[model samples]
Target: MTTTVAEELRRRELERYILEMEWEEQIRTRQAEKHFKLVEDVFRQHLGEAERMTIRQLITGAAANGRCEAMVYSFPARCCTDGGRAIEKNLPHWQKTLQGNAKELYHVFTETAKPQRYGLRAAVVDFAEGFPAEIGFFVTWEPLFFRSDESIY
Candidate 1:
């Protein structure tokens, strides 16, 4: 089947949480610890107990459950896709746009009273042996935040 720009993206990846930092900071680095802490902090410090039920309801909503908003928020790298390539190369502008309207998204994944449990990561994989190539990122379903865990990466 011919894949659309969106479908081609599927070949790329998906996920929520995983340690994504420099190799030197891999298994036994402070960065790994930081990643773990970020995840924990989301569950502990963020998950608003008072609004929990409401947020859960929103997540359960038909639209929220399957909406594409998460994609726009989590993978700013979507620019790498055919449709988004231009945007990716023009990152400064993209960041500017993100800094503007995407602040809410940033909050969900980066900061706020409680941010979404997600961050960017890169992996250096050899597409062809002896070739140095890196691919990074994982989209995750942060345990019951305001939204249901129906996330795609």
Candidate 2:
């Protein structure tokens, strides 16, 4: 049996499409592996050890920008016990869902920053398929007016 020219072209096109799809899948697999490794590294360290530079940078930048809040840390939502749903929904128990370094950061914030009138906030910073993909911890403080109004001198 002899193949027509149009049939030959269609076969080549289909083969090219399949190869492209496979390449895309390979790329995605590599990216996922890298992301998982990064997440693991973050979870393995205490916040003070792994994140001091990040915190300093965030605070410095916020101050330079004249902002009262800065996102000091972020991690994949998959690290959370509830996949960041609690944080996304703003639940009071969201801190309970935090794992590893995030939990440590929260504890340190509550113990130290909170007493100093600096606030800490956790929220889902990214989403995928209507679910949280990443969570961020933001350090916050009231501006002068609100601070004075509350007599937080």
Candidate 3:
């Protein structure tokens, strides 16, 4: 049987396409493995120590930048009860949607930062497919100026 040049080209093209797909799948598998490994490491770490280190870093970075507020932490929106809708909308009860480390961080903020006049704010920081993808917790401090009722001469 005689093979035409067009047939040879088609065969080569199909083989190339298959190789490219295999390469892409390998890359994706490697990325997934790395992600899972990192997640495992996070889960094995000390929670309180991690929280304290994060808080320290946030404070130090904010002071160095001469800023009163900084994003202290972020997490995937899937961890939230409403997938971060409450945070995106700035609702009062957004904290109730927090889960896992995000919730623990909020409690730490209330117990430690709040009493020290630091305000905590949660907001949706990223979106995917028109939905919240990640939520960020910001620690803020701004002095309150009280207006006096007395008239000035």
Going through the candidates in the order shown, the clash numbers are 7, 0, 0
Candidate 2 residues 33-138, lDDT tens each? 4333433443335555445555655665564444667787899999899999889889999988889878877886776567667788988899999989989988
Candidate 3 local lDDT, 1-153, one digit each (tens): 999999999999999999866655554444334333322343233356666556555654554444556786889999999999999998989989999988976776676557656688888899999999988887776622224453211
The CA lDDT of each predicted structure is 0.35, 0.70, 0.68
In candidate 3, what residue range of length 10 has the lowest lDDT sum? 144-153
TM-score for each predicted model, relative to the true structure:
0.26, 0.61, 0.59
Among all candidates shown, the one with the greatest TM-score: 2
What order do you get sorting by TM-score, best first? 2, 3, 1
User: Best by lDDT, which number?
Assistant: 2
Q: Mind sharing the TM-score for model 3?
A: 0.59
Off by over 4 Å in 2: 1-50, 145-153
Runs with alpha carbons beyond 4 Å of true place in candidate 1: 1-30, 42-83, 96-104, 109-153
Give one digit per residue, the lDDT tens place, for model 1 in 67-114. 311221233333233323334344543333333323333455455323
Q: Alpha carbon lDDT of residue 110, candidate 3? A: 78
Q: What is the lDDT of residue 128 in candidate 1?
A: 38
